[model samples]
Structures are given as C-alpha cells and as structure tokens.
Target: MKAEFATAERAVTLGVRETTDGLKMSMRRQVTSAGLGQRMANTWRGDNYPKGQNSIRAAGVVYTKASRIMEGFEDAAVIRSKDGWWLAIPTPNAPKRGVGGKRINPSNFPEHTYGRLRFVYRSGKPSLLVVDNARASYNRKSGQLRGFRKASDRAVSKGSGLTTVVMFWLVPQVQLPRLITFNTEAKRWFDRLPQLILKNWPD
Candidate 1:
C-alpha cells in the first residue's frame, strides 16, 4: 500500500485568516497607541517648527478621523479624511466656522471670523485687526467690536491711516509629523506577513 497524507488546504486557509486577523489587530494597536500620539504632539507643541511658529498641541496627534474636530482655545486641530487612516496638523489654511454654523473657506476665514480675531504688537505701534480689506474697530465703551466695513475715500486718502490696520491670520498651520514617523514603521509590519503567518501556524 502506498503511503499518502490528507490534504491540508483547509488548515492552510484557516492559518492565513488567523494570521491576517492578528496582524490587523497588531497594526491597529500600534497606530492607535497613546505613545505614538504623544510623540507627534510633542513635535507640534515644540518650537522646532519653521521660524518658531506656535503649533497646535492640544491633543498632540490623535488616531480618530479629522471629522471629530477638536477646538483648543481659539485654534483647532482637524484631521482630513483618507483611505485607511491619516492625520493632519492645524494649518494656517484650516477652515473656520462662520455664523449659522457654515464652514468658511480658509482663504475667506479672515473675513468670516473677523470679529473673533485679535491683533497685538510687541512694539509701540497701533495694532488693528483687518478683515476682508476692511478694518475692524472696537467700541471700547460698549466692549464690542463694531465689525468690518469698507474704508471710505477720506480714510483711504490718509497715509498713516493704513498703518492703523495690522492685518494677520489667526488660523494655526497644520502639520503631519506622524505621517513621516508612522509610514516606514507600518511598512515594516506589513513586510513581516509571511513570518507572522508561519509563526502563528497551527501546531
């Protein structure tokens, strides 16, 4: 009688599935670890960014979708939607919420969030908030901003009048240090698929 062995096709399939599940779980865990988020957050909170620009560090880097936006002080750190997973830093181009809960375009944010923006100068100079080519004046007596309005011909004719409006953006610049850190590490995990399957194979 010829010696034969039963086919192990079902066992092989099961092994593959189990290894896949394990690897997926491991990847998820690695990506969502608090340590990873904290590391990314440190990068943002630190002064290492270009020209010492203050970055967002409210939550550092989180794993959830950007749709679950977080508001920190007057700044916001939002994530953008991607295929599997991704993260974003608060960029100067980040959108702002206008009246009636409308999403104001980044370029138009200066106009939309006009009243909320504040302008301060370290030196002895007039610091005025300008929005949408209009200067915002505050009513000191009422403790309320008068809002934006077009400068009249008389106002425009004055040379020193323009200097009174110190226009600047209020949005924070979003960065993605996590992308740089996680991409290579995640690839390494994916490359170990074969070894993972074999190591997890049934005895």
Candidate 2:
C-alpha cells in the first residue's frame, strides 16, 4: 500500500487560557493521505522507537494518545492528548484478518462497526464526534473486504501481555469537528467515544 501525509504547523491553543466561546483547550490538525494499507504508522517513528516497533503502537492506543516517557527506555513515554479526545499516530503495518492474534467474524464490519454519530459543543467550545459502522476502515475492493479488520478481530496478549483495544473517530458535524478514527475494528470502544484511557504499559 502507498501513503501520503503532510505535517501542519501553527496550531491554535484555544482554551489553555480562555475563548470568545469560553471553550477550553487547543486544536491542532494536519491532513494525511494513506494508501489502502499505508499511513498507519505515525510520521515520527524510528526517531523514537526501533524498526518493526509498529505492533506496539496499536497496543498503546488502546490506552491513550501522545505517550510521554514515564520511565524505562527514553522512548518509553506516557501517552497524552490536548483535547478531551485522545490523539495517537498508529504505526502502519500489513493488514490482516486477526490482529495482535485472534480470529474474527466476517460480518459487522464497516456496515455495522460504526453508526449513530452525534456531536455538540460544550461551553461554547467547537467540538464534534462521529459514529462509524465500519469496525475498521477496509480497502473497498471486491475481495479485500475480508482483508479489512472484522468486528471479531483482536490483538492477543503477546510477549508483553497487552490487550488490543480499538479506537475510531467520532461523527463530524458543521457545528462540531469530526473525530478522526484509527485501527481496524477499532470501533469496538465506540460507546465510550472519547473516554480517555491512561495505560500504564510495562516498559
């Protein structure tokens, strides 16, 4: 697969202080284009983690975004995000039916994976969330559907013993911003759209 991504500078810190809308926090955004199976990896890899360090990203997002180095290797950091939502840059790897390691049902994919999206601004802050029936974003080719992640897809407890949780973007509305989603079958945690999870990963 092929991917194209660009970083955007100059993000605004909307609420670190205050706002006309009285919204709190900051908003940073950059547009990226990933080929069918590319762009899964974050732009800032290798610089931090070693090669083939991709699988870890998925495990990490199950917790939170922007990991901060809490201990262990300098690369080991605590995940964090500015907005109420978590922001993570998953390292891209090959696609598969099961993840980390587990079998899955062929149905309940994009069709039933995501749906019932709703969004609104709290305290004048512009925010949004999306509901996707697509458990995971799959290449819309004829036979490639299965190649995409299925609802039954899973990330097995590995040498590290990490649980593979999925993450997806929320519904986007004109009054609200669209939450960008990542992960195949990442919608499993859809009910708790932005309920930030702090993962104390063993380094």
Candidate 3:
C-alpha cells in the first residue's frame, strides 16, 4: 500500500511499491544512499539533492521501524507498496471540502464518509497530517497538515491532555478500523470505537 499526505497548499507522497520501491522512497526522502548528495549521486533529470545523497537514509529506518511507531496507533501496521516513491505534490489551495472521513473528529470535523488515519505521539513530539485522496486525486503527500493544530477529543485517551498527533485521511483507503486509545501500560494501541461519535465528549 501507499501513504499520501496532501494539503490544499502542499502535499508529500510516500510509497513502498516493493522491495525495489522502498529504495525509490528513500531516494525521494534524501538520496544519500548512492552518494546522490555528493558528486557521485545524480538522478536521470537534472535535479540537485540538497542533502548531497542519492537515497533517503531515514526511510530505511522508517521501514524497519514504521510498525514499532504504529504500535501505539493501530492493532497492526506494516509498510507495503510497489513504486517505492515519495514526494510533496503542491496544490492550488485548501481542499474545496475538508477530509470528512468516518471515525474522525465528529464533533468538530465534518462526517468522514470515506477514510481516516490516526497516529500517536507524546506531548510535544513532532507531528503531521498525511493525506492521499483517491476519489479526487489518488496520490500521496505528507506536508503541511490535514486537520486542526490542536487534535479534538474524539481520538485522545481518557483524561489525556492535549498532545501531538499526526493524521492521514486516506479516503477510500483508510488503514485503521477506528480511532482508539493508547495503552501506555500495555505498550499497545487497540482499535475500539463506537459506530458513531459519543454524544458527550468526556474531557
């Protein structure tokens, strides 16, 4: 599968098409693998890699560790794709309509009829919102954001204070079954949400 994080203004796409594709994704991230960051590294076109590398070194880390990171977000997680690509596709402006996917911020966000993605983070950790819309545009983008600066209570833990959260609304391609609480004690995150939003959002 592929992961796209797009915004009306900007978008970043990441994919793991296959074993070979993972390299492609890493290449898009930084391109330091084959010394693309240096003189020995270069792409078919005439693009100059700022980091001075031909492969994204971090992606390898991401692939080996994406599931570990998702342990607190989904019942199961894995990196699977074929193209192995990554990019930030720019857009004209904010989406004409916001990502109203199901099992999302129902109180604040429009009803999500399609798909949604949720990830976890500690209080103050870096976070983002990734989007890849197939009905409108089937591409991956991960830059900017997909929701509010402050995450709604719909997806937070019971009594958990406001913290960092990354979202990815994969309309028609949501990975998670539903929003869930992170079990810090068990060191596991499970999917157990109501079919509809709770009438009273417990603070």
Best of the candidates, TM-score: 1
Q: In candidate 1, what are the lDDT values of residues 1-203, reduced to their tens digit?
A: 12111123333343344444444444344434534454333332111112222222111122323322212211333434354322222233233444455655322344433333344433443333333234545798996865444455576566333323334433233333332333343355556645654564456
Q: Candidate 3 at 25: error in angstroms?
A: 50
lDDT of 1 at 40: 32
lDDT values of the candidates? Answer: 0.38, 0.26, 0.28
Model 2 TM-score, all chains together: 0.17
Between candidates 1 and 2, which one is better according to lDDT? 1
Instruction: Report the Cα RMSD per candidate.
Output: 16.6, 24.8, 26.9
Better of 1 and 3 by lDDT: 1
Candidate 2 lDDT tens digits, 41-144: 23222121222232222221222223221111123334445454533222122223223243321122232333333343345443433332224344666534
lDDT of 3 by residue, 168-190 (tens): 32221224332222233112111
Give TM per candidate: 0.31, 0.17, 0.15
Question: Which parts of model 1 have CA positions greater than 4 angstroms off?
Answer: 1-8, 34-96, 100-175, 179-183, 199-202
How many clashing residue pairs, candidate 3? 43
Clashes of each: 10, 27, 43
- Off-target runs (Cα >4 Å) in candidate 2 are 1-73, 88-142, 146-203
